[model samples]
Target: MATYDWLFSTLGLEQWCGASGGSAPTSLSDLAAQSRGETGEQAVDIWELPFPSMDALNDACPAFPQSRELTLGLEEGFLDIKDTLSVVLDPITQPLSWALDAALYGILNTPWWIVIPLLLAITWAVSRSWGLLAFVAACILGLAFIDHYDYAMQTLAIIFVCAFICVLFGVPIGIGMSRSDTMQNATIPILDMLQTLPPFVYLIPLIFLFSVTEPKLYGIAIILYAIVPVIRLTNLGIRMVDKNVIEAADAFGMTDRQKLFGVQIPLALPNIMAGVNQTIMMSLAMVVIASLVSAPGLGVLVLRGIRNLELGVGLVAGLGIVLLAVILDRVTKASLARINATHKA
Candidate 1:
């Protein structure tokens, strides 16, 4: 007999408990029965330990019996509302899809020669460090030589788009948070939830909300996962600006906007850039996981390797990701250094 069968029978829940045919099978007996192909009826496992009677518990708590019903109702409610949500969200989010597609297409279609030189030029302009420039050049060449350039570029395109959007939106939000205590209080918990939620969990609701083919599915996930650092850092940077500097700006007859742009933003540039660096790194980390939702990149190859159990493919793609991470990290840090130098001057 199942461990809880007697309790259920005593409580008049035998009908609900599936114990009528005989004494209900214990969990182990049920499994063994199934394995032996003797499954006329399956046994249900009920929580009975430390409880005197099922009826007592049920009478004491009607909610426990209704929990499954409540869950089903919630699921139905979400399904009913999902279409309404899509109607509202699609138009607003279309631009993200366009931006991501354009970036991916531009990178993939452009000649390697043109693309490589353009990247090198940008690296030189930002860092002005020949050593760093050479390292970036070498890394790109190596990725290309290994035929991982396309995958690398796809990953780069996604990171570039997502990270830019993060900075573009995150900075303003951070500035607002810095200016208003209420806004900060309102936003911090949301940011904390996003940062602490499991990375894979970000995709679950998104998968239901958008088709696998839509770039925005992964785009939204990437932004949500990576945006926290930039927002926090930007807020911290602006708030940390010296009061004396603000007073000087006011004394010089600077307007609020002027003080913010000329005095505060420049001073806050280091922290903002640091946030950008972290955002980029986080975006890179999500690339592989994002591939599950049709995000193309080295992540796709990594996924391929895992699914196929090909060690060489996974390891090589992983190495490509590491290389990309290093290149991005060095370039952003170098730019931050330049900003600090100018701020000091």
Candidate 2:
């Protein structure tokens, strides 16, 4: 007999399972019914605890009962507000949907020959490193050879769009934070919460806020999850600007705006670039988890592998992500090095 069976019977709750007939529960169904209080039977003493517990007055209360009611309540509450939220956010997010779709479609449909050369040219222009260019070219060609070119491109498109949006807004917010200690104090806590929260946690509210079919659903999640680094680093970069340099600019009769653009930003470029690098890396890490909400990329195949227990598929997809990550990391770091070199020169 299950340990809880006696507790139920003693409380006169056995009737809940139709066991008031005085026959012991004969099957799991009886136990289930008894547990659910669904057998049209009433407990003789409904106030009695079903499980053992110390007197609440004499000892610390035991762990709270695990219940699904809270989850149900949240779902209901979200549903109640979902429509209002959708109406307000849809207009703002619709453009993001268009941008993401266009990028993905263009990248996926473009020929390899054209895409490869263009990417190599960009890499060379940024880093001017033939070795880095060759490495990127090989990575792209390898992905294509393995039939993951489309998936790789899809992942790249999402990253490109999301990262651009992150930098677009994040830098300004960082600048604002640097200018106001009150703003920094107020915003740091929020950034801490966002950064420390599990990547999967980002999807929970987003899933309820928007439909899975919408690109902004995952796009928003990616941005929120990956944006913290850039913001924090940007603020740090600006704040770290040498005071002497600012004074020199001031001596030269530069205005606040001029000093910021000419002195602070130029000096802070390296840190800002580092922040961008970290943001890109974080975005890539989230791509797989974001797939749960219908974001596509190499992550889809990874999910497929896990669902179907396909070792080769998961491994190959994982390798593809690693290659993509390495390529991005190398190129960004190379560009950062180039920027540092230019500053030194």
Residue-pair clashes per prediction, in order, are 0, 0
Per-model RMSD to reference: 5.6, 7.5
1-345 in candidate 2: lDDT tens per residue? 333445455766544545333235545765776788765254536565344432221111112222454677888998899899989998998998999999998987888888889988988998888899999999999999989999999999999999999999899999999999999999999999999999888888888888899999999999998899899999999998888877888899999899889888888899899999999999999999888889999999999999999999999999999999999899999999988987762
Clashing pairs in 2: none
Best by TM-score: 1
On residues 224-295, what C-alpha lDDT tens digit does candidate 1 reach at each position? 999999999999999999889888999999998998899888899999999999999999998899999999
TM-score of each: 0.84, 0.80
- Full-model lDDT, candidate 1: 0.87
Q: Cα RMSD for candidate 2?
A: 7.5
- The list of candidate 1 runs beyond 4 A from truth reads 1-71
